[model samples]
Target: MDEQIITGATAAEITASVRTLHERGALRPGDALPPVRELAALLGVNRNTAVAAYRLLAQAGVVVARGRAGTVIAGHEAVAQEGYAPDSVLRDIGTGNPDPRLIPDPTTALARATGRPVLYGEPVIDPALEDRALAWVRDDLPGRDLRITVTSGAVDAVERLLAQALLRDDAVALEDPCFLASIHTVRLGGYRAVPVPVDSEGMTVDGLRAALDDGVRAIICTPRAQNPTGATLSPRRAADLRALLAEHPYVLVIEDDHFSMLSQRPYETLIGPEHRRFALVRSVSKFLGPDMCLAIAATDPETAERLALRLSPGTTWVSHLLQRLVLAQLTDGTVLHAIAAAGRHYAERNAAFAAHLTERGLPTEAEDGLNLWVALPVAAKTVAERLVLRGWLARTGDEFVLSERSAPSHHLRLTVHDLTDEETARLIDDLAESTR
Candidate 1:
């Protein structure tokens, strides 16, 4: 065992020792440091002095007390030093991520817009943006009687809608292997999560019916470009889901159209006219830019009223500047042209990856959005681990699971945009070898 000989006669000495350990790469994110008692005994210092030092680190976001898990290094600082800049990695085949290179350059436009100071107590949603947004939303939701409200993002809209509609411990149905953000939000809000099964055609109607039978009060569905799987609800599937939902008219149904404009697949709205309470959330992050942090929540009057209550004047309204910036890009012909180019690029690149996988005798399906969901012959986790060993990071299907079930899936979500022909071929070869 290494000797921890910090002769700290004072609190300052203890603090300095802790800082030195962090600076010298002794501690890292998710690494639990020695307990205060152990440190105190090892360093020949008073327990209070060690405690104070730990507290100081915690206050400075250097460490976090995870209750039973003990104190661990807090954020990205340690990871950054370890060369774990998540965004800089090659071929990040993870979540429903959009290519940052495609987002229109906002520097010049934002600088010009910022010249005028935004006044306090002004309307949260820019009128010009609202008009355009309404038109955009109305396009797919044609002739549907709905109202629109803007939120920071789709997740925010989900949280607020749930808060307004459901109480703690009330059950909400979600897609099994659901989006991580939805899982986190539902669990954090003290709600019971009911899992609805998903297959290639999207959320299964039978599974949703079972969740409803379990007394769920709400359901969050993804109709197109379902994250992690890149699955869309086929027309037949959508009709079946609508039929299943018609029975539970009072239950709040939230369809997160997260892939909205970026989706290369034809738009299918799951909110059937007969369903009395529902909301359709479409986010601009995947198409415009994640930093834009804008989403339009269109809902029936009752849910809209409750959502509006949460967004009242000062509470949860998105910034007008962001709204204006998004509006500018949405209306600009040049920006629209860029978005069209991005769509084509994504479809072509993903198709190339699918072909590469097929050539290597690996099963793969190329779909809309910026990523590909390839089905491996072995377990997805095993494949992901093998990729990690080869210096490539990927997300496994298990991370998306929301229910208790056996039978492992062989699917791996991969972002293929940045990969060249050589890189794609290499990835396919490695994947085939890993499976074998």
Candidate 2:
């Protein structure tokens, strides 16, 4: 036991040992390691040596110091193991992820721009990016008084908007079974979330009316491709919502057009001109790669000014390098081509799966965006568990539901874009079997 310690007394050696433990699966994500005092005593080293080693590991992303929760492994074993698959046996059908093949390679453009040193106080959002983004957003958000602010992502934009608009304990209306991120964001900010119902035509006007009646100060609505459901708001529904919102003119309406570029459905503007406060956030992460992390937030001058105040140049301005990269791809015609191909691919694949389910006597239909929302005869979690047993990972509808005491629906959000025909058919068959 005395001879088991690695001979080197240096801090670098201790850090290397900790990293080796993580690399070899001896440490795993969320697993708390020995305390600094305990490790120091065991290794016959000073407490400072152990502290420095842990800090080095944290910097390298090998471990995280969780304060009272203690230091723990940061990366999962699956991440460390090359090609290690999760328990999901079926091909990945759960995640609402874009096809990696469609993301155009940015390395070529990034390399060309690597020659310059990005200095502080320099323009954060690239001028070229601003020009192109403004033009692109204007296509969907047509109005004379709109101003744009660049953000890290759609989620980032939403968070900042909430920060600027609401104080702690304020109520924000969100679609019931909302996108999980929205739920987490609102909760983390200590705001109350008022649930609004979503139907085939997207968020219901009556639900919004109820939320407003309940005194919600803000509302986040997805006009098309409502996550986990793939429901697009019909024109009639949008008009109805606009009419309802007219009664409550002061409520802030945030229309998240996350699927703007990839959606095959017709665009419907829910934030009517009469509505005094609104912001339309469109993110490129769905159509482009998530690594780009760029979104354009358009609002009226007043709201824009408030949002802009939160985005001071000193704090968090969108990175110029990232902005330039997005601008290069967006303007090159290559990104548009890729988006067209991806949209077609998604539509065809989703249609094929829906057809297979229909043939099996299950009701199914194809919709826009990268994934399909399928209804099953059982609870979504049960269906998801069965799918996992069959080697496929799927997202349960409950994860997106924001309502309380509502009967759980048997719905699974499937990413069918990259599945082969045979694989798609097999999945349908397995799903049929699983439901039974």
lDDT on C-alpha atoms for all candidate structures: 0.77, 0.77
lDDT (Cα, tens digit) per residue for candidate 2, span 242-345: 88888887788888889887888888877886777888898988877777798988887888888877776757888776777777777767668888777777
Q: Tell me each candidate's TM-score.
A: 0.77, 0.77
The per-residue C-alpha lDDT of model 2 at residue 128 equals 68
The CA lDDT at 68 in model 2 is: 74
Off by over 4 Å in 2: 1-90, 111-118
RMSD of each: 9.9, 11.4
Model 2 poorest ten-residue lDDT run: 76-85
Per-residue error for 121 in candidate 2, Å, reads 3.5
